[model samples]
Target: MIVTRGSRLPLYLAVPVVVLLAALPYLVAPPVTRTLVGLFALVVLASMWNLLAGYGGMISVGQQGFIGIGAYTVLLTDIAGVSPFVGIPFAALVAGLLALPTTALVFRLNGGYFAIGTWVVAEVFRLVTVEFAAVGGGSGASLTGLSALGPTLRGAVTYWCALAAVVLAVGVVFAIMRSRLGLALTAIRDDPTAADSLGVRVTAAKRLVFVVAAAGCGVAGAIIVLDSLRVQPDSIYSVQWSAFMIFMVVIGGIGSIEGPILGAIVFFALQQVLEPYGVWYLVVLGLVAIAAALFARRGLWGLATGGRDVRFLPTGYRVAGSQGGVSGGGSP
Candidate 1:
């Protein structure tokens, strides 16, 4: 058997698909582009969460805190006389910086406590945001800076930005998972004490992952504001965002780049179908998640690959015989 580090097949196929998707705004109707913006947002959010929980082994449920921070950053930037469109990256920067101090607090806890601490941190952010009346406080605020662009142009630009965000999120995770950081993360995830003993710098790796994930989520939040043209503290900081991330990652398959993308599409499809059912939509989603957890612990992608650890993105090594095709490999 021969061993290979990466596969070119998925990359070859993805180029054309991405090109077509990028051109969709010009080719499709306005409503279609509008809808896809939402989908792309989900893809970005899910990918970030997967990077944190699946690859980094840090299961955070308060990522919405950073989402809110991103949204508010856009609002603040607009107030400072900057275009909200131009403020997108600043939103990510702000979130990452904030995550620095937050890591010092959340890293103190382990296992379930760490998760709960993250949620608490998110709640604190929401509470503090509510105190700022300049940004509409408890009521929320809209991006008045966007008014300079016409509806058609705004929608097109937002669509493009959302697409770029998806690319950025997926590309970052893919690159990280293929680097030494990915190896370090894998070591920590499998056995933290052993990884630390082996000089993996477990805490540093976790902090980096935490900050990067926060930035990614912040980008998603900024896109959400652009898509909706509004941001409410309660809404942006809602715990529901975390739930959506978990559901998408769980059903799509965690620990792999393709899982979140597949999961986001499946989740978006289910949302479209079940949205008209009111609260039952949530009920059905919960039921489906439960079913997936029990029946397919590895997720839809895991099943599609027949539990062989075959990767479309090929971030990890693959073992193959002279006959060709993937034989065996560890999880991405």
Candidate 2:
């Protein structure tokens, strides 16, 4: 049976249920809880990257472009007189919308070129913002008014929102993988030329995933900016965002939903323990990712789980000519 991307349970049921159950922090509300919220946000960003690069075969260095857009979207919307909570979704939408044009330029390249193009695009977006001195320019902008809400409330709100965004992103990806389009995407990712020969529209699938990934990044970016109450072009657009993403996916296990989430948990713990190491933090992260890529080609979970006995994502699939599409059949 060919259980491809198009056969998972509705991600809506899984993602939101987990997110709601994860509301442990709202009750406890501590510095540790806030850190966990922050960790989930990174999980969102990293998972999106893994989905894009791992499953979709699109490694984008410019995911931060959407990140900045999302942050700025929230900032701009708040300026237009909306509450921060409302401003967040609005920002995410705007970032997703902006990705339309950006896609045209970046998709013009391929492979390593494509990755570099994304980085350049991020820099371009950052530079444009910096040039607009009215909005705090190079020094960056602030979310000071959010602070007025009080630390505990602000933290809780942002944390919940982050959790929500992560759920939304994960759900969307899971759904996409289950749709016919996702079937097409899986083929393309595995072998673009071969898939194209078989009539899958590789370019369009890649583009759709890119836009979806961008939209998810927007929510993540907005939540992060809100939490920081500041937005510096350089920092928000830093290549480090890409680095963190690569670290999580590689170490956790690229191309699996569980991988990035697991990777983020490991990453956050490593950060807490190595907080005093300063620059070494980055070095350790790089080493971890590289080691995984070299030794554990399928990722940590792939190693631990040992080849497809379980899929949190149950892709519905069937043998090409079966009487019915079977439930929970795995990759073709």
Which candidate's TM-score is highest?
1
Which residue pairs clash in candidate 1?
A: none
Residues 107-224, candidate 1, lDDT per residue (tens digit)?
Answer: 9999999999999999999999999899999999888887988898999999999999998898888778767788899999999999999999999999999999999999999999
Q: Estimate each model's TM-score.
A: 0.94, 0.90
* lDDT of candidate model 2 versus the reference: 0.79
The per-model lDDT (C-alpha) reads: 0.90, 0.79
Q: Against the correct fold, how does model 1 do in TM-score?
A: 0.94
Candidate 2 contains a number of clashing pairs equal to: 7
Please tell me which predicted candidate would have the highest lDDT against the true structure: 1
What is the overall TM-score of model 2 with all chains considered together?
0.90
Each model's backbone clash number: 0, 7
